[model samples]
Target chain A: MALAASGPSERGGGDNLLLATFLEKRENLVLFLAARLRSMATAEDLIQDLYLKVAAMEPGADVRAPAALLYRMAANLMVDHVRSAQRASRRDAQWRLETRVTLGSLDVVSEPAADDALVARQRVRLLAEAVAELPPQMGRAFRLHKLEGRSQAETAEAMGVSRKMIEQHISAAVRRLAERLRT
Target chain B: MTQDGLARAQAAAWVVRLGGDATGEDGVEFDAWLQAAPGNRAAYRRALVLWCEFDARAGDVLAELTAVGAQASARPPAARRSASRLVPPAGRRRSALRWLTPIGGFALAAGLALAVLPPTVLKPATSTTYATGRGQHQRVALGDGSVIDLDAETRLRVTIAGSERRVALAEGQAIFDVVHDARRPFLVQAGGRTVRDVGTQFDVRQRAGELTVTVARGRVEVGSDGSGQPVLLGPGQRLQVDRASVSQLSVVDPAETFSWRAGRLVYRAQPLADVVADLNRQFVEQTVIADPELGKLPITGVIVLDNPRAVMTRLSLMLPIKAVPSDRGLTLLRK
Candidate 1:
């Protein structure tokens, strides 16, 4: 529906239309997130966050196209999260190898049978091989983030790079791993 | 598409798949990039399907990985030493292999399986009934300030909220003098399609899957849930939307629609079955037809909704029919 630009009296009409559209399109936006996040619950949470952001926006400000603006905002939020995760991963790796030998010295005994252990070792070997095949920086970011559990900011600091760069690295890492694991 | 265009599409798909929880300005750039090309939208949709497939199997993969990790940890010190040795000094080389190989296999299978399955379908809402017996005209003020004047033997439910205001008519009829609230558009969901209010007064009546909406003032938008398209009705227009079909809009007398709220039931060539259906709600025992064909006979007049028996007597005087109590319910037959 084309929104007519009229006097202040007609502003109410515009607001009503906008609110209606928002309600109708909110689910579509959530579906958009769920497709990417792979988790409906997480997507729902993000939609809630988006709702708060959208609701708080100044109404008087001219939103030339509400749908496009909403999508743009949602996209920016996702990118920021990816970047932070990247940074966290890098920092985690440095911490794991440098200050974490306690697990190595543990005297825990095994409970599982030999066959299970053998199978596990093989899986880890497969996983290791996959990571090894990743592009250098991307692989490092994934390890520090996923395996080591470092904060994205810390990972970025350890890598001595911008947070955005770290996110890009992780995204590439995940894509490559997802592709490689398929075979 | 160019490699750069493809990359951006992939990134956008990831952002959406992640539920937009990812950080950085890449999501914004990715969105802009996706909109930049029609090809990008198509690629993103493909990636989205793959992402959903991977997501469904994420639980299984995580469980398997945890089991593997536990197994690795349980091994003797010597085995861990050998495993650690296999990890190259360059962490990058090791990480690439760690995530790529196993995850890729499961994700691809899961994606293909999910794609082959049909999309999920949502079931229609189960209806709840609200009815008033014969000879009783009740006025109900809804939560949203809209008032409903239920004619005798009418059944309806009012569901109102900030997001949506809906009324489901099970049987009988009601006159709605709806309060104007733009934020919450009022609608009567009955007979598959919804009679949506566009800041107007209207009356809706439903009987045996046959329903009608009469707009006295303002406008109404009528459309089925499956079809998003709506037919808008202006003031003084009456439309019949039923399971069988929707009738052409006819200019109606606004008073004829509002007469029920004023304690009078007005009928114009309406069936005996419909008149009895209206009476059943206003009266406890209800009027029934002895002959099946008699129920289909038409009647046209104004019945002052007062005493149930009095209305029935008046109805019998106008038509050659007499009311009789049967084992099932009240019955009416030719005199």
Candidate 2:
């Protein structure tokens, strides 16, 4: 199948076209990787890895089919990634176990300091109450955006409000709570 | 401390302590506020000391307050004194009550918090959804750049992450023109089995416990999530997986399965019942065959998506069937 290809001139043209096609389809390539990797960022990183592999391939290599070769390389990369992830997870688990003893001692010593903890509890409780007392809309916005860890833009979108409105609500909420808790 | 200095210090403390763990930006702001004035620095130091002191004893106080609050809320006004006995000393009782008042108010504050905070701060990392309303065909370009052409009244969830790309076909049919990425394997979960890609284009259709998968390019491994070697499908190969049995491999035009995405419906010697089922999803009025035997009749043709009435009229002319509008839907019967 490799020998059946036309002369050097035709193969060179095909290689150039294939390289362009690969570059043009980078987004599609990332999607393909993301679907398997389950993370878009990871997929993007893999695409870079794929590009480097493709770029390093020897020039004027007799290629029976370019698209098939591309797919073959991609398949091989996935197998290698899965093997490495398994090793990393195993190492992480071991590290967690090793550090547990040192961390445990710090926790034990901290437990005896009770008065400081009581005051902190009072402050948190006060803050929580102040938040709960806010108007329903303002309260929800604050909880989802502040406590729950959503972005201001995402919170606005979810609540069907503008980002500016979200910002205003948060500022007002903070001001009101600060005033109430001052006493 | 001067009143203004104390006020600024308190505000900074609230912003930090009540801000729910300090973020990087918060740290920067705190530093800036401290350096803003010498008095500000002194006030913050005092506030920080108070905050640290509070943190050390908060848990035990919170536990005690929780029990007292629950008791206070549960009992009648007459039973209130009984709950108060649970309170420790005079100072402890006053502090506990002070804590309870605010804690009770926190539930109200939670609602305010949602409105105030940024959505990204609370949103989960990712969520997947697949939806198709009546007579609607939708296409979704996933975050990964893969496009899913959903058949009418279909639903599916695409879950793409760094480690795996997965699509769960909850219902209906879809054509996937997958891009090959070797670092991540694309797998589609449909019906009772999963179809794992080998750099391929494919169509998976699931209806009433019957599932069919057709591959256009590369290879697909079709197997139940539980056991058995998956049936491998090369280009132009089709396989059916179901609870009762897996069908033998067959050569078929994979394009025919995907034609619906182009507003064309192609059927090869299919049962009238099956054709009606497909049409039902595409039209508002349901198509039904009154005669069971007539429903068993075979149908074949390419349906160009015109209006529902036009398509029904054309179907009636091509076959020995009539369309009757009923309360249930459009019924097909032997004419």
Candidate 3:
């Protein structure tokens, strides 16, 4: 809890003003990046990068709002990270396609252990059953969006319903299924 | 609805939001919701695991669903496109598939869901087992910043639940540095007795059906439910239980019991056999007293456990004894 509040004082006494300020708002930065990146692990990595960049930065800069500058740098880092990840995924997809004919979907599905496979299948069957037992419209929306590959907007258009209505249907359907499967 | 039920419903709503065209604001709100309560995070984690599992098995589940649908109704062509898109032709395969899309947006939340979920869905907890071999000392650092220093020949199983942090000391000893959480009590069950700590540092040792609890900081309650009234122990207090029932409380310097963490065995007028028993745990080669008379000899002073043979040599100098090297261990006899 005191990770941020005490971090600045513990690290830099007075000389490193930027480092102190960064440390002071470190926890806030983590939260902000956590929201933006959607992955806390990636957000943490980005924060570490931000800390390094800030520590090595020139002490005196004509900067207004250090927090804003910090966030701007973090956002740019995230963008770069996302772009690189996308490029990597594209390459990985290309490789998979090239090798697919010989491999024959071998690596596509991970082989769960024998005992675990049975249990997982049973659980999956229960989930499918729960989905089927939902109200017809709600079930259809869930099947189209969640079970199938359709986005909420696409599912809405296919079902001839508003996107908002589809979203409501999905949330309700998921709630019902989770409750049923949990017991 | 119960609080847990509400939390589950909220988690379901968040899952749908994450699945759909979720805005940055929605991500922020979800993060806040996750951090709001431990139960919320637990419920969300449960939901996410199922969500991801379904995503992983989307193809198989869809094939089954389609089969079931065809068996029930004749209208299968209209629903076929959406399901078929999940597994497109090799050339037209989407780089960002179903698994990547949902997981990427909710990646931070997905990691927590990997821990084991017990049968009790309402109070989700992850169980971890920690053990140390002879002459091995280990420090188990928990996610909550609590540190458990396991002594030689120790076996501890920790179950961190929403309501409590529970540990079962099946054998040997461990020093627990419990994180302060008043809402969740840190409890250790050993030798048919339970030791509950309220934000404290304590050492619990259970060897051959005998239990001893020494508190270094804060307070601890030692008892079993419906057995008798539990005794409260504060700093410098120790409680010893024998034969799984009788409890004797005494004043002791907690440092003497906790010194094992520093690799020093400090004893004050303890039996030679008891001292040898502890040494056996700390060394590969065991030490056995040849005669019962020698076993009851009082041992006092510090025994540094850098080397087992050196410890035996030191024991020989301190007492009038001869250390006879045997096939199994060193046998001590009167010189």
Candidate 4:
């Protein structure tokens, strides 16, 4: 009920939507890239890789949809980075054993910095408070879909409601959270 | 809605939709939306940051939240490893959240993000032991097309010969899809119980010396060593054997048991503590709930196995909870 005036508006027009879009959304994309990765360093590396790939593209090479293509390239780079990281981990495992990296223990994953973890801990409280303030149904919908990482369809099925309801609840929950969590 | 409000709403909707299996058009549309206005991207980034935070900390947030009017139950004994999870949660999904074990001290290094190593063995003809790391899953195809999907932190050995097919599931859980060869019986041994595949699809989960077998298709026979008490499980039938060697059979949807291999967790009105127990298995971080009452809250949905930290960030939003660093990965407290 609190989401009637919220959600995407049907509007699309020409506004120089190529490399310009990439520049405008670079910072936004950095947040996105960072979120998808386990560390800011990896995200930064991949974003740089993405820029190179874009710059290296041959000009006037049938670039049908530049903005869409840019985003897709970004996603592709992310996927590739993950695949390489996986391979490196396997190799690292073998390398650690060969070099006698440590004792009998074989824990390879990198640990998060204590300072970063502390900042995250504070942020979790702020976010959780905002979620607790939502309407009951809205809260549940957001929890199941957004927090639990369930699909909207899965959230609908779990709640015994329609997918549309889940979408509306999600939008409302996000709007409320953004408003409340703003510093 | 004001301009900012409208932008946040659209951004939120886009995040949800794009998070799911978005197509090429959605990307084009999203790009157009991004190019249309500058504020839209900032608003979207704000929403995205929160979304990312939740993905990272899913477990801790759940530990923090207290459901409205939920019973503020006392904490189960810390040493009672599986005792907390043994408490069957509310709803028709009685058999749901059968994590069965809530090991608070299930020691894992905190803050480390594990990358799931892909299943190494593609085709196995002889006896080979396949193992997965903590929070890792693998699907192995046998020399014969029979597939065995392994859950997180599992160890199993498989042997295939002309005479018979044998799988020794030493620990963890696996779903077996066997190709019917009447001459060679498919036998799986786990948690002191042997599950004989009478040409069926079934899942066997063994955690902390407790085992559960759920049959999805065809039939399976569960038996203890040297005992005539062989229990038969048909489609939708489940058999659970506890640490005390007590065996119980119940009706359950096999799909739920089969969900983990498919990269998602399916639960219906499962309690928060039990859900956290499941999360603990899939993550290196152990989420400890400060208030035991928070564990009573029911969670109904699927949880995509992203990293644990992001999930915790999101959990804080939906539940009355927050988290702090602890000896064990994270300690969750009420907001």
Candidate 5:
């Protein structure tokens, strides 16, 4: 049950290569799926389905380039989900937006220091301030992806920028936010 | 970059890279980097914590962005320049829908001026601030025939220039009936998001880190501030952007959303916590759910914005709950 082993050095990168690649990109794949599917919860579900797909792979399956195959598989799974989910979601478009996707179980409330309501509010204020402080382009990028839950591709499309640019902006945004909130 | 900055940047890059491309060489490289230095792992952990926080509180962050963005943009130049650094891309076309949501059934909050809607009266540029205290509602009529109904404990700033009609909802809820003057489009710059009217009537409510926009008439476009794909909401459609998360579209009865102006809060299948938060704003005395699980109870009824005691008494009969006197106000306990 070793979910991941370091690179190809550990036991000649045989059976675990695909699983390792899948494990490494699991979080990123969620983003990739979320952007296309417009739902984090669904993306998570797909990631699980992907894990099963990878886990069930023959141990001796001589697969060349596991990463590309893994992503392609994820993309295909996403298409399947989207095709099926479209009719059901649209027909029942009576849902609200409080769907809390526990990405890695980000237990922010577990912090002992900010236990009080006031401290939590102040922390939000700080976060908002840092985000608001970002330049318009970067700020919009952060809002659309982080705040609005748009995929980097969708965000790029919305901002009329390249997907690479959206990624860069998000990276920069995370860097800037971390720096500002460090204190 | 400084040593710490280098680590932070690398950490951010790894986190972001994983979001886009974490497989193949990228994954191996990241693994090597982590093992290469102790500081690298620490840096990555630090960035991850922050990233996770953003993911967890995405809704709150967005709402706060709107609430904070409203105030940041409205602050005097001295404060504004230091905060945002760059100005709003004024270069972006200001062509907006002048349709501010109108309070069709409510009177003016300031003074009962003209009961008749004002014609398209061109006026000198001015900025006006309208706010409501607890247990108070105000209807504000702008010169452009557009009307806004301010709910309790709401504050908004209205600035009408020769070219644009902008309202920043710092906090609270407001229904807008904007007049269709294409020349001066009505744009509501909330926190970090903008609800631009498309010759439509809509309600924009920003609370905590969540924003709910329900379009009652015509259509409105809700987008993150400055730029991004604006979500077009049509009549009887509601878009709820919960703290930096998903912009959930739902079929809602517009009457339920707009009923607040008529002195009754209409809710259909909303959580009891959401209902209580709304009540707390309307009344001086607050209602606290002693049981966190009790807050998740679905409430579907109309609550008159009268005294808290009367409202609670009526609510208790409808639901299995009892109100006990507490220091802050009344705590709702299971019967």
Candidate 6:
């Protein structure tokens, strides 16, 4: 089946206008779902599910605002299906994480190539070094919020700062990390 | 700003916006922003890649960060620069519980430790590394009277830091007869899982990618360093964990499992590949399965740690398999 077709010409825009808009914002939707679900892998699957639902849709009349309807369907799908999917995927992810041959102390006989693992380990080291190089406030906020997986409010409480300030620090830290590591 | 820089900045913004407790309206705006231009989407995708990569390797990064933070903390405050310095976060507030402590038993264990500590403080850190080459066996007696027997091709690092007696098993297997110290929790970290004991005799084997912990005497808790329910194993209980999942506990004769200490490799319905792997570590000549299907064949019974050729001959008699000498090692094939 044709999973996707480019947005129809302007004359036929209304037919799959919602799908077109959804496609444009597909990455954003995945990110949104990822935030809610705490897993990008699960978010990606849900997006595919959403795509199937949209693809199988029968041709309909002109829609006034497709974005609103698209999100409505997306939200409904998440409420109905994604919650259970999230739980199941979490258990699956746990098993996956358990089985992954990380660069831990164990000598995994069937692990990835040594060079590949060393490169990834080196990247991780670089990321840590970048985090260490961040401005003190940004570094502390990032260490508490991202690296330590603390809630913004909790991090704020720990650092004796407002949650808004923590958010700003995190945003700046993300920007800085992206700038530093993209190269 | 360069287009790349602008894209990265936009990507970073999206990450924060999407990652935060975003409402439906924020999602709509994000979608609109993504639709407005192809560059936005590409930029966000770039950021997402980094975001996801970091998420996948968060454990390694945090461990490295912690190590760095620990070192930085040891240095004088005036000597450190504020811009590049970072302290441990609040989430890991309880450093004493840094290693694995089984769920529900944390309180009980901590309470026990409180009552067990001596009036005198523990000594400074004394780190030791123990390793055994192929066909070699070594036994180590720690300062605390705990003895460890290292099997062939094993590498283990031991450190007595303050009240914690920690050992990191990098490869191979070891039988730890730990002297119980209520105050000093004996922890063995291997393959992202920790085996913690106050006093116990346990066999921990990290062969290939699988980690097997068999408790012989007393009780020991095995759990992932990541948040999960830690399992407590009693004597005669074995927990076998491959990289992917933890196998159900099998009632094993600790002696049979520990027979490797006496140079006898015992197997009970283990795959031929695993047996071959163990043999590869013990002998200089590697054993390779020519037919992939033959590797899955289950082989049972005891195989003495004799020379590779003799062992392969003995194996050939039991299974419909023959060994051919390859350029590098011995390859097993179906007869």
Q: Please compute DockQ, using alpha carbons, for every candidate against the native two-chain complex.
A: 0.05, 0.01, 0.08, 0.10, 0.15, 0.15
Off by over 4 Å in 3: A1-183, B1-124
Worst 10-residue stretch by lDDT in candidate 2 chain B? B113-122
The window of 10 residues in a row where model 5 chain B has the poorest summed lDDT is: B93-102
Candidates' C-alpha lDDT? 0.54, 0.55, 0.63, 0.63, 0.66, 0.66
Please give the TM-score that candidate 5 achieves against the real structure: 0.42
TM values, all candidates: 0.37, 0.41, 0.41, 0.44, 0.42, 0.46
Q: Name the top TM-score candidate.
A: 6
Clashes of each: 58, 76, 0, 20, 25, 4
Question: Candidate 1 at residue B3, lDDT?
Answer: 72
What candidate 3 keeps of the native contacts, as a fraction, is 0.17
lDDT of 1 by residue, A37-138 (tens): 555565677777877777776655665555556666666655554456433321211111111111212323334576975675455456555655667677
Give the better candidate number (1 or 3) by TM-score: 3
Better of 5 and 6 by TM-score: 6
Error of 3 at B280 (Å): 0.4
Report interface Cα RMSD per prediction: 24.9, 23.6, 20.8, 12.5, 10.4, 10.9
DockQ of 5: 0.15
Over 4 Å off in model 4, which ranges? A1-183, B1-114, B120-125, B269-271, B296-298
Model 5 chain B TM at: 0.62
Prediction 2 TM-score vs. true: 0.41
lDDT of 3 by residue, B260-314 (tens): 6544576766778899999888777887889988877777655555455656776
lDDT (10s digit) by residue, model 5, range A1-183: 333433443334446778767777676566555533445677789999999999998765665666566767887776676667643442112111232211122312233343574586678778877887887778878876775455678778767899989988988998899888886
Task: Flag the better candidate by lDDT, 3 or 6.
Answer: 6
lDDT of 1 by residue, B205-237 (tens): 776778788887678888877775688888878
After superposing candidate 1, which stretches have Cα over 4 Å from the reference? A1-183, B1-136, B152-157, B324-330
Q: lDDT ranking from best to worst?
A: 5, 6, 3, 4, 2, 1
